[model samples]
Target: MQRVLIVEDDPLIAIDLQHMIHDLGYVTSGIANSFDSAKRLAPHSDLALVDVNLVDGATGPRIGQFLAGEFGISVVMVTANPEVVADGIFGVIGVISKPAQPATIKQVLEFMSTYKHQLVAHPPALRLFTCDRRGPL
Candidate 1:
């Protein structure tokens, strides 16, 4: 199953994401509220729900980059930051708006579930496998 990390400082949001992941057929791998903790914990996830603004600062873009670029974790940036700054999250599969709707969340989770690799400390570096390539590749 897809393993997910929640990098949201808001406990309620994190818990909601956890519940949603369960409903979507994934596991809650970990949760972090800051950039440092997210960095340490992200490598363990196959995918991540990253908030652009953290309890400490705006670290979601960084987390998104690190998770996707370094660890091969599929990052779905969940934030209210509709600014172009959202464009900076390289290697990210999607940029989801905050207060995620069940429909949108399910869409992203369904996107992730198609991949076959099991989540571990670090997923294998297969660029295509690590990405969301549509339509029977």
Candidate 2:
């Protein structure tokens, strides 16, 4: 099972995400509400669902870059403020608008897991940097 890190500031949301991930058959590596906590949990995670405007301000992009670039983890931005990363960020797969449906989350997790381990070519419906189905690719 793949290990996922939830970088959300809201405790309720984080717990909800943890339960959801667990129910989806994935392991929850940990939850981090700040950059420091993210750094500590990075090595143990294979994928990360990050939120912007975290407890430490709008550092989701930075955290995503750090996790993806430094740790080679697959990062998907899960932020309500999708505009913040509209231009895309280095090392991030893409952004998922907040209040994501369980089906969307499931598809993304499946695509990412397969892509990471098997180098799968297709991406989920989300606006991935490599496979932008909604815009010019």
Candidate 3:
């Protein structure tokens, strides 16, 4: 099972995401409300569902870049303002507009599991980002 880390500031949303991840048969590595907490849990995570705005301000993109570039973890931004990361960040696979539906999350996980973060045909619910000239790796 994929070990997922929820990088969201809202406790309620984090809890809901945790439950959804569990229901989908994935492991909840941890939930982090700030960049410091997220860094601490990055090593143990396989994937991260991140929010653009957090308790520490707009640090989700940085978190995603860090986790994906440093730890080789797959990163997906889940935020109310998807436009913030519309241009994309290094190591981030894509952006999922909030509120993300259960079906969308499930499909995202499945796609990530199958592709292992490779740039390929992605789920329609996910807005793919152009991480680099070659695309997300």
Best candidate, lDDT: 3
Q: Which stretches of candidate 3 lie over 4 Å from their true place?
A: 117-120, 132-137
lDDT of 3 at 19: 97
**Per the 3 Å backbone cut-off, how many clashing residue pairs does candidate 3 have?**
0
TM-score of 3: 0.92
lDDT of 3 at 116: 57
- List, residue by residue over 1-137, the lDDT tens digit for candidate 1: 77888999999988888888788777888899998898888767887878888988887777787887778887777777646453344566656667777777777766555543543232221112233322233
Ranking by TM-score: 3, 2, 1
Candidate 3 C-alpha lDDT tens digits along 1-137: 78999999999999999999999999989999999999999989988899999999999999888888888888889999998887888778888989888999999988767665364578898987766323644
* Candidate 1 root-mean-square deviation in Å: 7.1
**By TM-score, who's the top model here?**
3
TM-score of each: 0.77, 0.89, 0.92
lDDT of each: 0.70, 0.84, 0.87
lDDT of 2 by residue, 25-137 (tens): 99989999999999999989998999988888999889998998889888899988888888888778888887887778888888777765465554444677753222334
Model 1 weakest lDDT span, ten residues long:
120-129
